[model samples]
Target chain A: MAESFEITDEMKARVGVESPPWTFEVTTTGVRAFARGVGYTDPVYYDIEAARKAGYRNLPAPPTFHGTPIYIPGKSEETFSTPLECDITVDHGLPNTIDGGKVTEYYEQICAGDTLTCVTKLASLDLKVTGSGITMFIQTIEFKFTNEDGKVAVIDRLKVINH
Target chain B: MAVTWDNINEGDSLPELKKKPSLTQMVKFAAGNGDFNPLHHDFKYFACEYLGSVLVQGHFRYAALGELVQTWLGHNQGGRIKKMSCQHRGMDFPDADITCKGTVDKKYEENGEKLADLTIWTEDNEGKQNSPGAATIVFV
Candidate 1:
């Protein structure tokens, strides 16, 4: 027995709407902790001199470190737990959400002190079938991060399923 | 530790890397990375309501894979990860030794810089792939 399904008209209209771009300032502690959290012990990710020796102005973030939204527009850290990374999410009243996958492409370096802007848009929503003959809805969202100088730094594409 | 262009070849393998992640490490990642998804923690929420046990996060696997690239290619070295992607196929727990491996699928020259495309995947002790994907790195 499966649960009931309902998608409100408001949610459907929200599709294709991009949330305002949010900005996150890269920091050393953030980078070092990000490196350590993943069990990476490279000095360049920790020490300033090591990073310079490696030919970087400062430590550039590693993959997936920026997956979560670290900043939001018009939000203060003192008021909220954390800044929401600007993203558009369509809630179609589908209780069973699925994880499809994530694709990340890097262009410029996300060095320390570089303020990056992240803009997200809903790409698609479609019906998918599972191996067990279950009907599912797939939602794909895309986010592009631009460096301070306006050059593209990275683009993260995420896909999820709603059942 | 520069991953010079001349030292790599097509079909070469990036050295394998393994990580025995701990609960504390996962928590730290959640706190630092700003991903406080309840699924990654909250014992009761994980055990009673969710996937039997607290599933190790997809970010952990992705981050570990990133570490493998940085450790092998050297982060500051001219080798920059142009693109890295992962598709989750299975659920993984925190208690397992996650093994990450990659193979150089092809090598070419782009914009006067050497580049390599890699086929990368992560598996558990059971040899079951939890996440599989591809990455392209450029060595300048």
Candidate 2:
């Protein structure tokens, strides 16, 4: 048996607590790499002329590109946390961590050169007793991404499972 | 030949899209995605902590699914993908053969726009599902 942390009531109370905003830039270099990395062949995401012909200002932020973190130039990479922002290390001594799921809604298109700011919070925390007699806590974190124009571009809800 | 609104029906299955993303692919994706997390490429940390040799980014899998859907719906100018959701069921290690498969859940017309709902996912070499998700695409 692994050492387990006790889930405290205080930890349960921290649900819905919002974290600080994370700001990042959408660059063409990042866009092309991201597109090709996933084997994306859309010319709009690669060739500039193709993009302009497709009616976008430039390479647009691929659908889930916001999920990727931006490493600002001249800044320490360690300074910024990964996209999964919730601190799972609470009093609860959960031994294993796993990603549960993602629910995302896209409102407006995010184009290259657009600056984005993401504000996230622990949206919900729930404890369940499973068939295996194990106590599991499912934490849902919500991320709000706003474009430079101050409009909501994408809203993502991610669920984390700790057991 | 673009997949138009009138061509396909519900219960139809999309061809399986498979790939074993190379290390070069992961690195390139990490560079463009702005994610330099050690868990992605560092074998020691990933094995010790995440119980995997090297992990593929969750969004990386999503990108593959996106491409699969776009290819199925055809890259024509009229189709628009409105939303997609993913439920990560398990971890995918580097160089593992992952296959994507899906079925057209339903088809309908909303305000004159033809649309199809797809239930999709990616599985590991063992055929265990890693990411199960859904996508909504509007056809021309």
Candidate 3:
């Protein structure tokens, strides 16, 4: 388990702060496991010849495979702390949860042997009082993925929720 | 066979996926996803610590939604999907009947491949949206 950061008043003011860029080298094993984890048994995720036949330089990763690079060990930890505005007295129970649900404007397909670099930043944060007893605090974190040629590959917008 | 835009239209709803999440299902998914958060499996933890009975991991519903998408798209022969995004709106306790559904919002060609803009959502027996989002799939 990783150490959790304390949410101070200053840190709370900077809830939507940007972290330094983190780079992850795409691995074949990571790609295969993600596809299989989602129950996709297609050969394109594993068979190199099939990928070549499909116009890919090598076996390509699945669409959702990009999360592996961004969500791995150290890339998204400090960003996982509870935002300052959350009304909860302490942060012990829930995992800082965020789900990115939006259209991904694809610029390029990631083929095998591609080293992807990601630049992540906290985009926005808001606190709203629901009519019910629950108070909803939402934080948006955006991550941009770029390939070896410095071309943008994908953008991931993750919305974190604390109630 | 390549899927064409003319072959489909907007407001086309795919078959709904009916599933009941069991404790075993939650445990398996939690294990597979490396999320052992007790909120998913620990009944006492949820009842005592979090004020719930038994809950399902939100990602499990996303995976089920993915299943519904693959089945709707008629299998992407060799073409790979570009991306999928899902917004989770509600929670699923154990033994809850969850259903997944989607509609073809539009169709267009991108980079020489036929693509579909699909708007998808999931609902439970009581008619609550569980997860809502869109997926851009290149039809092969």
Give per-residue lDDT, candidate 2, residue B81. 69
DockQ of 2: 0.51
- Give the runs in model 1 whose Cα sits over 4 Å from its true position: A1-15, A67-85, B46-50, B110-113
lDDT of model 2, residue B102: 86
For candidate 3, give the lDDT of residue A90.
28
- Report the lDDT tens digits of candidate 3 across residue range A1-163: 1132233464366555555566655666655655555555667767788767766687665654443433544323333222223212324233444443443445667766888777666666655555664445566667777889999887767676665
For each candidate, the alpha-carbon lDDT, in order, equals 0.75, 0.75, 0.63
Give the fraction of reference interface contacts each candidate recovers: 0.66, 0.57, 0.21
lDDT-superior candidate, 2 or 3:
2
Query: Where does candidate 3 chain B have its weakest 10-residue lDDT segment?
Result: B72-81
For candidate 2 chain B, which ten residues in a row score worst on lDDT? B71-80
Deviation from truth (RMSD, Å), model 3? 6.7
Taking all chains together, each candidate's TM-score versus the true structure is: 0.88, 0.82, 0.68
Task: List, residue by residue over A1-163, the lDDT tens digit for candidate 2.
Answer: 3224345689877777787677767788778877888877778888888888877888876767764565445442452235434343245566666667787777777777888888878787877666787767788888888988899988888887888
Overlapping backbone residue pairs in candidate 3 total 0
What overall lDDT, based on C-alpha atoms, would model 2 receive against the true structure? 0.75
What tens digits encode model 1's per-residue C-alpha lDDT throughout A1-163? 2233444577677678887877766888888887777877778878989888878898767777653345544663422224444446775665676577888888877777677787878877666567886767777888888887899888888888777
Where does candidate 3 clash, by residue pair? none
Best first by lDDT, ranked: 1, 2, 3
On DockQ, the leading prediction is 1
The clash tally of candidate 2 reads 1
